[model samples]
Target: MIKFTLVLFVLVSGALFLFGSSASAQNGTLFFSPATGSFAQDDSFWVNVMVNTQGEDVNAVAAYFTYPEDKLEAREINTANSAMTLFAEKKYGQGRVEISGGKPTPGFSGIQQIASVLFRVKSSSGAATLTFASDSAVLTDAGNANILNLVASGKGAYVLKAKSSASSSPTPRPSSSVSPTPTTSSQPAPSSFPTSQPQFSLSDVRVDTITGESARIAWVTSEGANSVVEYGPNKEYAFIVLRGELAMEHQITLENLSPQTEYHFRVKGTNAADKELQSEDQVFTTGALQTQQGKEEKGIFGGRGLFIGGIIGAILMLLMLVMVIARKRGESSLFSQE
Candidate 1:
């Protein structure tokens, strides 16, 4: 009877392990769209990093990845039309790119495209693969923690074929070998230059108030971002202050300024993807200092008034002495005549 009961329990456990979708499955599955493809050298393509929340409400997502630098180069990240409005960080360089985005609770569910990366092929007749780093995460809104875990099973693989004859001449071997490295860089993307990077736009930047001793600045963003204010006596921006919280409205105050002086300033902040961006050069002149400097100016003018009053009194006393001397001389002359 004991052996039969043990056998029954084993069979039931096996059935649950094969069919269960809760604990036995990873709640979040991160993957790339168009997981496999083929392209020629210098051909540009885009790959999207997607996430499936698996019915769990996830608030944050981080997708940092690496590719073979020898075969591919990441060009840019575009989030213009994406669902995510808050981007914490976006970086691409040295054959690696990272993108982080999230929203406040109650979080997001279902399949979502976090961001898209554009790449240019460098090698001909070879393969390239893009894989996510181990530390990437999809944080849940609840406490069970990944509840289970996350997986990056949908890696992107591509084949780089030889360039077409017209676009790329094959006979010049030296140039072909050296051209791959600089070809993409030489392509002028004037229109997309500014937007190609992971940068945020700052609007309604206002100097709320500027006093001799302190100044306040306020600005707004399209989405949540960190706050940064840089100000100095010149464009060099000698002073910098920042607040690391994520919010749509931002304000920063700068203190200890010289009265009646011009200060050059600019504001910097991060997008939902954590890409740093700065505003144009701005100018603000401090009004008269309210406290110690005001007293000092009054003292300076007061000294000048006292000095002028002393000169006038000395001239009047000299004139009065002369008049008294002339009267005494006339009286002496009259006495002698009498």
Candidate 2:
């Protein structure tokens, strides 16, 4: 009986030791770039996913995460099958292998803590949200050291700032004074021109019936300035350089486009002072190859010139008829007098 009791005590001690090691071995962390969680389409961006292997030391890390396909575009990630690399190897003390989709959770919530994380995103407006939920993952063993989960999750969003000279806030100034005499005086108003920054806007846009090559663009401005355009086929602009030129007028014709292709585009307006204002971007596709150009054609007779001529001719004919009737009545009166 004494021998059996001693054996049981030894087994319990070994089990507790294993459990303690597993609990202390796991960790997780998340990192992103641009400081502001936003990115432009066709722009390159990244999400650095890391895991802390308590003290056991790890040779590899594997993780999984979900993402919102509508708002973000993902490139390569740092994992077994992605664009990222092993952020830190097993020898770097406790560090993470940058994975593509691993996300972080708020530290305090139980449900949020255990959730799997994923993704760095790019958007049209350079704005989007990255979210994580309550989920669990399995930690595989590298060799002797077993890993415990230190799962974490949190929220991140992306936003693109507009380039405008317009004031984001109201400007303050001292009040004007008037003389005590019975005379009135007027002061010239301050000018909105030569502002520290310029303002921009886009409007009156139309697509052509031909291939994506031609697009008609027009817009208004508070201050007159030149314009520029940036556009491409993809949501992200990694492989292509910006396409732009200098011009005036609220209208322009864009030509040489691909058929049935989707494009994203934005405009920048510059003032005389060389200040720039940015307009919100928009997307469009070239019409079918067989579609006719312009909404409708104008006929010559239906034009203003023909209509004006017809009005003049009708007035002249009415005057001639009235003069003929007056002459006939005057001649009949002279015949009766004779």
Candidate 3:
């Protein structure tokens, strides 16, 4: 009995030790300002990309912005006076906007503005959503290793209203050249502009596989674009996976999930012309705790601990049974002699 007790105690202690050593990684946040707003046809506005270290220093960042090409157009990108000293911007086939930048000497800490983008509302009335391309946005430290546990809130939507006829009249030209130039050039009335917006879609969104601590999501896009997934315990979608490359079919794997917990996720992508597409929110529950136990068995004992534990337990049981039988036989013999 004592030997069995000792063996059980050791097994329990080892299991606890393994679990105690598992620690979660630290994290930060990246978001965009003006998360929601409204714009009129022919109106132009700016949005700022911001980052919060949540108390960590970041040296580099790359962000991809996507919008509706038929309803909205990116006029320009401005990074002047931002934390990033060096930066580059590019526009691709549809409506994809890519911005990569970094600071060398002193990394950024706390909340800071990364860049500003100017967008113009086209002659259509509808909703337009701006999103960051999956896997395309990343934050890195001085060593160039990605900072883990990043919370990205780079999704925002705006409603476009039809331009009022009274507001479309041309402003009187200034009598003097001293008058300041208009910030926006005059445009023809909305009636002359295109009436329809460009269309983009994502299909075949499915959860490929889900384990205790990881999941894989796959989908196909109507057009080639960069892939990204925003997922979390709920719809807030605090975590993101940016697959910085462009493709027609996209797959992303999310790791370090909790066992048997529920998670919500959605897909976002941008084509060459900067047109962005988003999937509807979906839910999935991770596998049971048995999956985690399998991981521990593989990691702690390297596929041998289970066999060894079973052998030890069997030996202890056998010894207890032999001792009981021996005691009974000895007692019987003594009685017969008396």
* All candidates: TM-score: 0.41, 0.26, 0.41
- Candidate that beats the other on lDDT, 1 or 2, i.e. the better one: 1
Candidate 3 residue 166 C-alpha distance from true site, Å: 4.5
Better of 1 and 2 by TM-score: 1
Instruction: Residues 187-261, candidate 2: write the lDDT tens digits.
Output: 222243436554444354433333545676566556665544555676442111111233445554545557777
Which regions of candidate 1 are displaced past 4 Å? 1-25, 147-152, 166-338
**Tens-place lDDT digits, model 1, residues 15-56:** 324332334346576766555567999899998777766667
Candidate 3 lDDT by residue in tens digits, 26-66 = 35555665555678888999987766555566666666667
What are the RMSDs of all candidates, in order? 21.6, 26.8, 18.9
Q: Which has the better lDDT: candidate 2, or candidate 3?
A: 3
Predicted model with the maximum lDDT: 1
Error of 2 at 240 (Å): 31
**lDDT of model 2 at position 222:** 66
Model 3, C-alpha of 73: deviation from truth (Å):
0.5
